[model samples]
Target: MSRYAETYASWRADPVGFWQQAAEQIDWFTPAKSVFNPASGVYGRWFDGATCNTCYNCVDRHVVAGNGDRLAVVYDSPVTGQVARYTFGELQDQVSALASVLRGLGVTKGDRVVIYMPMVPEAIFAMLACARLGAIHSVVFGGFAPQELATRIDDAAPKVVISASCGIEPGRVIAYKPLLDEAIDLSENKPDHCVILQRDTQLCDLTPVRDVDYAEAVETALARGEGTECVPVDATDPLYILYTSGTTGQPKGVVRDNGGHMVALKWTMEHHYDIKPGEVFWAASDVGWVVGHSWICYGPLLHGAATVVFEGKPVGTPDAGTFWRVIQDHGVAALFAAPTALRAIKKEDPKGTLIGEYDFSKFRTLFLAGERSDPATIEWAQEKLDRPVIDHWWQTETGWAMSGNPVGLGAFPVKLGSTGKPMPGYDIRVLDDAGNAVAPGTLGNIVCKLPLPPAGFPTLWNAPDRFISSYMAEYPGYYATSDAGIIDEDGYVFIMARTDDIINVAGHRLSTGAMEEVIGSHPDIAECAVVGKADALKGQMPLGLFVTNNGANRDESELERELVQLIRAKIGAVAAFKHAIEVKRLPKTRSGKVLRGTVQKIADGESFKMPAAIDDPAILDEISAALKAHNMIGEPV
Candidate 1:
């Protein structure tokens, strides 16, 4: 039997004691006066009055423990046909040298540094360097539009901006220097210096006095033997400020503390992922995302596990088998990726033939997050890889998994439709509009009890008021997850959809995610998205858009008819799922989340801002054309 029940009960019994025990794994300069201070900032603070250095815990401590030769990072870039590896010792040298350079540039404790670069080892070094100096780092996704980057720059007011000349895509090179320059020009807050890493794929001109060559600066620092040591900081000090899109036009900076973040992420590396020291843990996500921050950079390093910095797409990075090749080559133990990636690979290689090309003997569990994992994708991955396809739920606010099957605790039974049970420290509850408990298996708002566990954001950077209003205002003593889900009698949590994705269909509430799951299960369909469109009589109706699998040639009309029938049979006629359109592809964010809200706005003939994280602006036009061809666009209300 799994130890999940006993472990969870232990945490529930003494949340502070549980986290305090986990804290012993990290190397702290000063032990906390109190494991938790209920009178601390916002909801509360963990490890109050402690002192720690995140960079030292992640890098230096490993060397001091005689594990310097152990692999730390594996940089695999299929797009560039390059591979590089670093040990704990090499990582320490790199991070310290860069920290010295930043210190020379006047970046001190409490200052903010903005990192805007591609998936290169330098980006990781930049983040660690900032932490070494007790400075906060904010990583903006490379190639973000100038306006979006400018907004982040204004909000962060960074003292220095570290970026690259360009980022390489499947068939093209995106020049990032021009975008960074334009963003700096557009923003009111200007950094004192800009460090640019010039990639061989593309070169850029740098402005004198403002732009600094990354290699030259690092080489000088190394040659002079001016490596900087880690600076001790309060446990409550901010480690990084990650900006997520806000409901308002501005971006909300999610603040992560040094102490709680290290303890929590280190615990997850062993418990949630079942990864051990020296094992290879690959989180196939960009550094700009929370997954990259926690898993790819910090979590694995803190646990002494090797992390993979992959710079390629799930497909078209040569072919659909790239992921398997990397896993086999690196001896990856656990791999975490978004569901959209699996869908893309499955669409290109429908028969799972590419997976057989590589021997992934070391690969263990496959974790899926970022977006809801439809049962179809999970089943396909499980069948092809013959491994557990664990779908966990988390957000940018929470640096680690909220609900997941604890593989190290012997893993609970796999429930295809549910995102497992709540992990330790998360007291999940389903509540109605009045904040009352809802019946089992009934859809309602999902929330967690007050005083969220460690690694969760304490407050929005410079905006505690906004944090309260955005997340806690509506649910009174609870931290509203803003997700609509159900809990079965067995205690499995089924996250059906975002609260906004729930539709009122003829006075009945229906989940678009449920409809998408059924439609995606059809053999011909590779992936699908369901959105609730405006309907005059029924308040709202479900609209389905899907892409077909490779080599699947069926009449569009027949496929549409089949999809409609499938939904009706599965969800009954209450779904009103009449409109099903086959498209070349669905619009998605760079992180691979479907832009359903944007699609809904377009279908309703309502104007919507261009999403900052959208993968391709052109995909919106394609979606619009498809809606127009099918006469699905409704008049603007």
Candidate 2:
């Protein structure tokens, strides 16, 4: 039975009384009598006026309970096979020392600090250190090129920048000092100083005017006894700026508040993961993204759980088995990574030498996010890794794990392609375009009606108007997730795809993601992208483009006919493809996101606009070739 199953039974029976009890978990400056505002459609407010420092909630509170000596962080160094563990007490001290260094460089409350580093232990240290002194951190994803790096630096102007030697990325190690050197030469507002974390663990070779070694700086500051005074922060104070790849095709700075983010993530860790202190845990996404921030750094710390902030990709380095090795080599209790990582693993022969050696006895919970997990991948992982891949669904806007197949308490009968039932102390609904609840099994946008739980929110940093216009204006009076999903009879959520990812073929609506998955599942088709192409009679038709797993040259007519048949088999005649173009590769962003709109632009007989951020522009040619071969010839895939 789920820990909250009885409460869920009662809550489902009478929601009004259920939240009245749920609201008692936190410290509230002003008491909220109710959890819902039926009239406004907003339903969350916990401990109104409550003020708590996020880092404090993460570390100090745990220390006060005498678990200070317990593990707070586990560092699985790819360079060294050793697992570095830091107790809550030692982690707090390091965070304080780093916070002092940040303060010494003149970063104060409300000042922004841009952190571009690999998912190393220092990345978490820098983030919490900034939080300790009330400095908002804007972390750019580590995989970005120099130009995209500059854009983020421009967006979040910081007094001091923290960067690491990018030894972990593909090909050349992206020396941060060089990029910092170039970005500084270009920017009018260059960082006052640059603190370099030697990922190469080597001293800086390039010259930047005010460059300082990160480790030595912290050590020097600690010796001086001039540590940071952990400032008292307000609930509404800006905590950190996490950038999200919004539909606008540019990274939107999602400015999250300290208290609100803390409350939400902490609640999620406690209630969803059922996490306990001293347990070793790892959230596989890098600290550069929200997953790294909420789950890996702040949330775990806030809740007093030990966390692993790894620096390397699972597939890179000596072998793909690195992640499995880390899990068994270290007793990782809970592990979280994106389904993107898993899909890549799935594409690799499942019988690869990597899956057989690990001991999974220590793993209790595993989370898959970034994108929805294909159910096949979930079952395969369950059998291979010897644990359930709790296929989770959430976005950058939701803070942390909003919907998850809860492992410890709320395990339900696993539904193929379904994220679990709603979490404790929260309510979720699937709403139509009209904002009314949709019938169960009928697809609708996911909506979290207001009075939003402490962490549940709708905002784009400081831009309230943008938040209102984007989330609110879409469906009117509801926070539209923009993603298509359905609520099963058991209240489990099955996210289909992004809502706009639909196509009309002979007046029949079809989802490109579902259809693309069908194409990708084909034996020779290793990866695929399907999009709607404008047509006269049909209005729109499905056009597919793909990269073959075996990279075999095939008869164009034969391959095209085979794909059409595959779609017909999976989705019926109504959703069969108009044409398919087999390509060597599809255009993808650096983060492995397919540039779907770019493909649509090509299909529309228009010139595609490239985001200046993409690291490789050559891949666009392959899309063009596939499209041309399939007679999608106006432009590209």
Q: Evaluated with lDDT, which candidate comes out highest?
A: 1
Report the Cα lDDT for candidate 2: 0.70
lDDT of 1 at 231: 100
Lowest lDDT 10-mer window, candidate 1? 243-252
Q: Give the winner by TM-score.
A: 1
Range of the 10 consecutive residues with the lowest summed lDDT in candidate 2 = 40-49
lDDT per residue as tens, model 2, 1-637? 6665674567567655655554454343344433444443222333334455667767766777898898888887665444577888887888888898888789898899988877677888888888888888988766555666676677778898888755455444555667666776777667888888875454466355677788888888778866766676666567888777543455677767765566567657766776776677788877766777778887777767788867666565446777787788768878888765765565554544577777878878778877656665676678777776687777777676556766656676778678777665446788876677888988777876554555555356656677777777766645677888788887788777777777777867677877876776666655677878887778777788776653355676687788889889888988857588767656764445677777877777777656543546787776776566556756322
Where model 2 places Cα greater than 4 Å from the true spot, the runs are 3-5, 8-46, 79-83, 143-147, 165-167, 184-190, 201-209, 246-250, 434-437, 520-527, 547-563, 581-592, 603-605, 609-618, 635-637
Give the Å shift of residue 575 in candidate 1: 0.8
Model 1 lDDT per residue over 1-637, tens place? 7999999999999899899999999899999998999899878899999999999999999999999999999999998889999999999999999999899889999999999999999999999999999999999999999999999999989999999999999998999999999999999999999999999999999999999999999989889988998999999999999998532388899999999999999999999999999999999999999998999999999999999999999999999999999999999999999999999999999899999999888999999999989998999999999999999999899899889999999988999989999999899999998899999999999999889899989999989999999899999878899899999999999999999999899999999999999999999999999998898888888889999999999899999999999999999998888889989989998999898999999998888999999888999999999999999898521
